[model samples]
Target: MVDNSQGHSAYSEDALLVSRMNVKPGGKQAHMRDGWFMRDGVKVIQQMVYPPDHPEFPNEPKGMKAVLAECGLSQQRLRGKCKKCESDSLACCYKRILELQADFQEQKSLMQEVIESMGHLSIFLLKFTAS
Candidate 1:
């Protein structure tokens, strides 16, 4: 992993002490988390601003896991079973979600595979003309 510390000194664009910018390592987005070396040092400072879905969600102490669990319980019920009417609508929705996730996973495995199968899936794009 590349050292991406903002550095002890600040300088211009052409400075020699420049750091890496969100480069992926081992084909994965690398988290240059200082937590590995420094315990409890991951706390945010005054000037720095974190974004949504940045692991540390803004203004809410409850983490993403808590948030997602709350949402699933309230919205769809995490067990993928219907809360109201004990209906299979929830199961159907969850099944569709799984199908879409699988499709996306399959597409990400090889870009060419999606291109080869574009003729079948791309039909949705022409929804206006499709009878």
Candidate 2:
């Protein structure tokens, strides 16, 4: 049996009486009862969010199994999830900081090289002028 637990308003009789002229044509606006359209004993309820076990869900946490079993609904354990997220964010931030530090070191070295070359040019100009 199709799960109408989400409160779809589809009727069974319309599907069986397909040839009857009075039967509403099947569509979103067709056999609508209780805010849902009927199509072969199935209600046209939106099914965007699949269960956690579904492959489309992606990286379903082990903690989610407990939530589904206990509450019959999917819920995140924010305490643990948030902690892990914060740790990952911190790691990313540290990695970026190290990269920036390396870039800054390279720029500083280039600046030092330019300053030394300018000093040598000044010394050469002074010696030639003195002669």
RMSD of candidate 2 to the true fold?
30.6
Estimate candidate 2's alpha-carbon lDDT, on a 0 to 1 scale: 0.27
lDDT of 1 by residue, 40-83 (tens): 55432211123355554342233212322332322344333123
The true-versus-predicted C-alpha distance at residue 109 of model 2, in Å, is 8.1
lDDT of 2 by residue, 26-106 (tens): 222212111122346665432212355665433222222232223233223322222123333522322222222222223
**Alpha-carbon error at 112 in model 2, in Å?**
3.5
Q: Tell me the whole-model lDDT of each prediction, alpha carbons only.
A: 0.27, 0.27
lDDT of 2 at 63: 27
12, model 2: CA deviation in Å? Answer: 77
Error of 1 at 16 (Å): 38
Off by over 4 Å in 1: 1-55, 58-74, 80-98, 101-108, 111-131
